[model samples]
Target chain A: MGIQNTLEGSNTEIPEIGALDVDKIKQDFPILQRKVYGKPLVFLDNAASTQKPLQVIETIQQYYTAENANIHRGVYYLSELATQKYEHSREIVRRFLNARSLKEIVFTYGTTDGINLVAHAFGRKFIKEGDEIIISEMEHHSNIVPWQILCEETGARLRVIPMNDNGELDLDQFRNLINSRTKLVAVVYVSNSLGTVNPIKEIIQSAHEHDIPVLVDGAQAVSHYRIDVQELGCDFFVFSGHKIFGPTGVGVLYAREEILETMNPFRGGGDMIKSVTFERTIYNDLPYRFEAGTPNIAGVIGLGTALEYVENIGYEWIGAHETEVLQYGMNVLSEIKQIRFIGTAQKKAGVISFVVDGVHPHDIGTFLDREGVAIRTGHHCTQPVMDHFNVPATSRASIAMYNKKEDFDALVRGLHKIIKVFS
Target chain B: MDELRELYQEIILDHNKNPKNFGELPDANHSSEGYNPLCGDRIKVFLKVKDGLVEDIKFTGSGCAISRASASVMTTLVKGKTVQEAEELFKRFHDLVTQSPQAEVNLEELDKLAVFAGVREFPSRIKCASLAWHTLIAALKEKQEPISTE
Candidate 1:
């Protein structure tokens, strides 16, 4: 089970009409061709990590097989080629987020890494005792724990904005939590557990009014639709490449050029510094200062391909197709009398968390696996969400572009079998 | 179907529905919590030891079928035995589940617990199946901190 994060979540709601050629798109992912337990795999765990396309898979294969060299510091022809490919991916990410410059787009291992980078660099420089950091209750452990550690080490305290019954955050509570000592507002763009798309623009506007920076944990929302950092005006945005059908290791941390320039380097390493003497060391420019050591060269390149793959297909159709599938899934699952859906937010993407009556999510997971249906069952690294809901665990079926109505049918069938067997 | 049935046997299901000794022992001298972080299953084991023998035992908290049943049956078996015998039983059960399927170690000597023999087939569920036993050890050992099966 994957337990992961943000938004450049702007105004793209599920429109009344748009569609993707999902059958054709499914062919692009080679793993979809295989079967598990003599049954065709109905993958519904996209929120955990997406199945990579052939385009991404081959790009990685091509990189290791032919173009393998350390980037940023190279003189030879092969090294130069590798550096260009690496930097080219950064430019691709910049365009994807519509960030002003490449200086703002820092390559990270994943969303967790990016969040930690901000926590360590920004927290050290700016946050001190009695200062406050505000986060919502529904944050993935990545977003919560880093701030918690920052609070613990720096003597700064953390404040939480609570969510209501429908799994939507109380904006009133969020606004109240913001006051004079509030250094930053860190919130997820889309909840990985609840699939609630946050009103990040409003949150950003509120925080900007107070001159407090906001970090949108966009790990879940990036692939759902297009994300424009400039449009959202968020100070920092972070997302994992793997969550969007790219390689696992690469992610993007889009700090606004001004904010990126303010923080110190997260880690000290070779490429992160411009020059180093015995007495002193000078760190590299804007994003590179944050990107220490040798980056995930192949992963970055593969993420570039994944982004291009999404671009070629178009986000409008992807959003509409996902909305339809999720709606159909909710409709069919609601018909089951025993099923109690968790995260019933009006706006959701790529996740359905639920618990069946007289059946534990763990058993449901085991039974589903036998039928070759893949779903996640656990806290999903959101213990607060589970605690607030008062369930030990939940069965989650998350979606991606490759999924269809048949996947929902298959899940409903597997659930029915579980009920029958238990009964 | 065979594996699924074997895993969720009638006895296991029955125990899961009506777990034995499922409560806290208010008079207990020793107690410890066992946590399966994977599923967020937590069970607190409370033992009343009198003159080196486990006079009474009970568990309180929640978990899945295999774990709940295992804890239920374990209380029934360990109630009358000495702490030494309980430890031996833990070793035997651990061997039964952790050993490769090809390695035949007979569980005929143990009752009800043999239902957990199927757990070795599903590697992920093995931790779920054994969390109670680990907690039992911690309780007997007088460990203060909660034990975690990470």
Candidate 2:
């Protein structure tokens, strides 16, 4: 009936799902059982937002029940416990991203908040009129609009790195765009719309040659592939915890220590200030400087648990499994007539975008959902990329480690129904 | 999957395939551009309003089926209606589209429009269905030239 139900012969064992227990993995997510029009749910919208696992959900509940108090200020037992766990979460994120220092990590709301932070703090301080901020045509609106806002405010110019027909970034255009006037290069590490894994390390290195800082939007990249901030050498890296099977409203902004110290604090409030008076306020150091309010305490703890879950699974093995699924999905979908796939870059995560002849994407999504399969059918938050590809929208099927061959089969079957209906 | 035919009605598919009034009105008296940055829906509403009446209405855009079909249904309903009557219809349509709790209307003429009532069940698609309605409202507001929703 579905991919997960049919994939039972694999020898590999998932942590709790048993021997190739794709069904067990599906069982861990409660929402999978949800009936949309009285049928099982087949969620293929991981690129938009991932469904939380049981461990991540239980950790959030356990946090509110066992440890719930104001962090950093209170000296009471609960507060101290909360503060320790909160800071420990920072350490966990630091380890997750392989950052050199815990002080480099600052918690924000999500990718949008993280980008705004860099814009407000970094753009306000260093970026001047006529300076250039380079970005890709394939970037999500979160990456594009913030830089536009920055440029509008500071009188800076925004430079775009164009994409080729394959939805891959034109590195030559990027190279040509990077002049001495370029102040920043903000690129999405893995495009949410195209699923193109950008050559960010090379992009960062090239920017560094001209002494410009790069901010990698790792919102889509973090869960798909392993990240080493030190290895990538990006100055500012941002990602949402929700994208990695954790809670929403909590994200990380990983900036190099020196670069972070150079920028001013985004918001001045209680935990972020060193000493406050009616007249003047001294700011706190490093990460605290950026984290202003009573941070999402439970959210931070839950994110910590999420990172732990990812680490336990081992990113390498997860990547391998997802690659297998991606390949299988691409191969299967390619065989379907009138199904034209977009974003055929050699290097990609588990994202497949396509448009079928004579069928609207919404019609396809509706038909698929009737059969308990869910997929995203829209511009996927990157209109400029869609414009580049000369299409208005596409149906996106993004997979995760839990997605097996049977899921691909189910999608193929759904597409077959869609084609028949359209014909 | 056969049940999906309920949502993607033949009328809607027909309209989406051969959209009504799908062209630019070069002699339009009122025009307005609408954009939904969330889903990247871009639409330009062109109205030939004269003597306080809508002589003709047209739209041009590339969006999901809900948006295109809704726009198609909207133009057909509003053509030849007075500006005042169209405005009232817009109010009624807005309430219907949003599935307002106090919605009170008969859907005899709004048959294709009634199909969009299912859009209310999907909150995300509500905007797609309403994009052209808002653009028409904008066109009514501008009443001359073209206004950008930037």
Candidate 3:
């Protein structure tokens, strides 16, 4: 390497690579110009949460502005309007997932709360003593601990589907772990930590053969892949709205109609009840039984809008674009010798996790921030995956619809500067 | 790019690469391990304390740059200091990394340790920078050979 290409011993100056037109994307968000550290903020933590577009924001505003009222039950005009709008959002979610029916879609707070609800309802009711729940090693703590609690309570066992050296789930091990005792198989459709797009369709099919229910944690998958609940044949599917560029405090859980009918209610309150008395309470049918309380009204509407926006753009183009950007990022980052790119899976989404030999991921993130580059530097809410990889943490860059090739170049230039400092 | 140069100043990288007082203390009187579960950082801190004075200090771990370098710099500063002095150093280091810069950290005494002050600006890395310090404190609290974060 030339002296200019080195961090210290070698020569490398991170080039003046540009990024997405903040001015253009900012036109959509209307929050990008705000100052942080007295500079333009580079928001690189998309995997944690995504920025909302004007359409989603406006949907929330419009909901409150024109169609704000309590839904279902009320006979008044405004109440009916709110009920129709709310139900319309459910249809959007149904179409988004290509679910069999709107009844399959149950709204919750987020993916964590959704998973916990299933653990409490489905896992608690149907799962018997000594039954097994298989999850991949790449699961976030949210996916792991709930089943752990379920197993402890039910005397069931929690089995792990191990990953190979490339951070991909080992199909052989997955098959070995599943048997007559296995009741549920919950796995991330795309790993948040590694960005590996799992073969969930095949995984779900195999589980179904054993009469085992599968729950695909689509928190990281929804934004990257085309999800069809029926096509995948998964018993249940869950994802957070925020991860798909929607509002926080909103999530969707899709369960088979029969499964939803069988599972008991998780929480008791208004709206979930069909008829209430001092002696006995009758629960509402389908989704309303699962969704108690007032719910995140505006959040759901905004999520519908977010879904509409994504559907308009189309997942095929988005997936192709993001995959290309990730490949380009890997190529650009490879130019810097000291940088060690992690998680090179065969089927990956837009995420790229890496480490520069001499520089820490935190230092790299901090340095990159100074140059208007944003990325995540941690175990990414998946500590077990980190342990599997035998790495403390890896700096992650996840691309969305808005990210461009120039963004990858800027990231490369930022890594070059990190190398310069460390070398 | 120029601004990033300031964040990853040469001194920080030097400490990261050829860390001072690196390695393990085989005959250590005290040791402890610290882990940042969120990031998977694991650091083992070893100390040789004789008559309330820290005669030797060392560390070993694989982590992000901030963590490994933090351990590296911590070992260099704590060695040859009294246990009480080491405790105070811990306090100073904590303030230097977690809190605002106004807190007095004894810059000359800090030497290479000062390079890590920039870490405070990045809130997520605070745990990485403090992993070794927490382990050292745990070691002192137990007054034994050591313990691990797990």
- The C-alpha lDDT values of all candidates are 0.88, 0.84, 0.80
DockQ (model 3, Cα)? 0.59
Cand. 3 TM to true fold: 0.89
Top lDDT: which candidate number? 1
lDDT of 3 by residue, A111-152 (tens): 999999999999889898988999999998999999999988
On TM-score, the stronger of 1 and 2 is 1
Worst 10 residues of 3 chain B by lDDT: B1-10
On lDDT, the stronger of 1 and 3 is: 1
- List the candidate numbers ranked by TM-score, top first: 1, 2, 3
TM of each candidate vs. truth: 0.95, 0.90, 0.89
lDDT of 1 by residue, B18-66 (tens): 9999987877877988999899999999888878899999998888888
Cα lDDT tens digits, model 3, B1-150, are: 443443456665666778777777778778887877766778877888889988888888877666777787788778888889889989878878877744555669776667777776667778878898899999877677433443
Q: Estimate candidate 2's alpha-carbon lDDT, on a 0 to 1 scale.
A: 0.84
Clashing pairs in 2: A3-A406, A3-A407
- Going through the candidates in order, the fraction of native interface contacts each one reproduces equals 0.74, 0.44, 0.96
Complex DockQ, candidate 1: 0.75
The digit string of per-residue lDDT tens for model 1 on A259-367 reads 7788867989888899999999998887788878898999998898888888878888899989999999999999999999889888888889999988889999998
Each candidate's DockQ: 0.75, 0.46, 0.59
- Residue A238 local lDDT, model 1: 96
Candidate 2 has a TM-score of 0.90
Better candidate by TM-score, 2 or 3: 2
Task: Give the number of colliding residue pairs in candidate 1.
Answer: 6
lDDT of 2 by residue, A1-423 (tens): 122233222212225423444576677678877887786677788988888877788777766777788999888888877777778788889888999998999999999999999999999999999999999998999999988998998899999998888888889889999888999999999988778998889999999999999999999998988899999999999999898888999999999999998897898788999999899999998889999989899899778878887787777778888998899999999999798988989899979999998876766777787788889988888888888888878999998767788888989998997787667
Candidate 2 lDDT, B52-90, residue by residue in tens: 889988999877777888899999999999989888878
